[model samples]
Target: MNDETSGKASIRRELLASRALLTSRDVEDAAAALAASALELPELAGARTVAAYVSVGREPGTRALLDTLRARGVRVLLPVLLPDNDLDWAAYAGPEHLAPAGRGLREPDGPRLGPAAVLDADAVLLPGLAVDGRGMRLGRGGGSYDRVLARLAAAGRHPALVVLLYGNEVVARVPEEPHDHPVDAVVTPAGTRRFG
Candidate 1:
């Protein structure tokens, strides 16, 4: 593998291993802290509709944040993984309405909105293994969020791009490619980091 590919693989392995060490109580506390930190962001506060994802396994939990958004009556959109690895969004009804989807993901069981539905969001919460100081995100190498970012650029939409990760995942640098897009901010259990 090339340097870029190998570098990303190394980082992903390290981060996932660290996450695997967390206990159930740690995850629960981190989830609550993450939600509080994210809610304080002005972008999220002013957003009418936001695009977000679910946290599976040991990933930084988004459940608390999603529930808070729904409780506050803000429109929340959750992604449905398309067969092509692209994301199709759907309105979040609640935890009760989520069904077990492929890939250990839970998606909202409601009418499907086309992938372009992301264009309507004022903020987007991304899932990633890590993010660098320059706001360049290191995703799971799934090529999913990369396409989402490219689509947003094509539509001339500049919504607040945010990634939710663990505290240590905010690192010094991350490998980047030509197609990679910089995020505007990140929310971790510790606090929030803003870039640009």
Candidate 2:
């Protein structure tokens, strides 16, 4: 399977390495604190509605930041995996609307909307196996987020794409596909940096 070859195995390996680097309690605390402070960015400060994914596997956790955001009056949106393996966007008022779902990822419990609604978000926190300084995201080979972000970009509604990762998950470069979605920034324990 060429799909399994090109970028998939590399991503899986990176995910493993990232998890190893983050196993320390210090890294976890630092990452969480940085993610929480991202909300104070001038660009994100006034954004009322924001979008984020329920992280799985080796990705850094977002639960702490999500709760902090909600407390600050920011509306949060979560992704629900649809039947075709695509994602449906829905508003998350709180934890009560979520339950265990596809691939063991948590999703919202109620109605879902189209990609257009996702694009309406002020910022999108993308989950990835690895990310490079250039802002390239390596997802789990499903292409769901790549497809969604592409559609949003094509319409000229470019939301701030941010990648959350453990500090060591940052790499020199990641293999890219023609359809891969590029993020606007990468957020790690060290700090936030803009990408091209």
Which predicted model would earn the best lDDT? 1
| TM-score for each model | 0.98, 0.87
Give candidates' CA RMSD values in order: 0.8, 2.4
Error of 2 at 26 (Å): 5.7
What total of clashing residue pairs does each candidate reach?
Answer: 0, 0
Clashes of 2: 0
Model 1 TM: 0.98
Write one digit per residue (lDDT tens) for candidate 2, span 55-97.
6554677777777778889878888887886778887767777
In candidate 2, which residue ranges exceed 4 Å CA deviation?
1-8, 17-31
lDDT of 1 at 88: 95
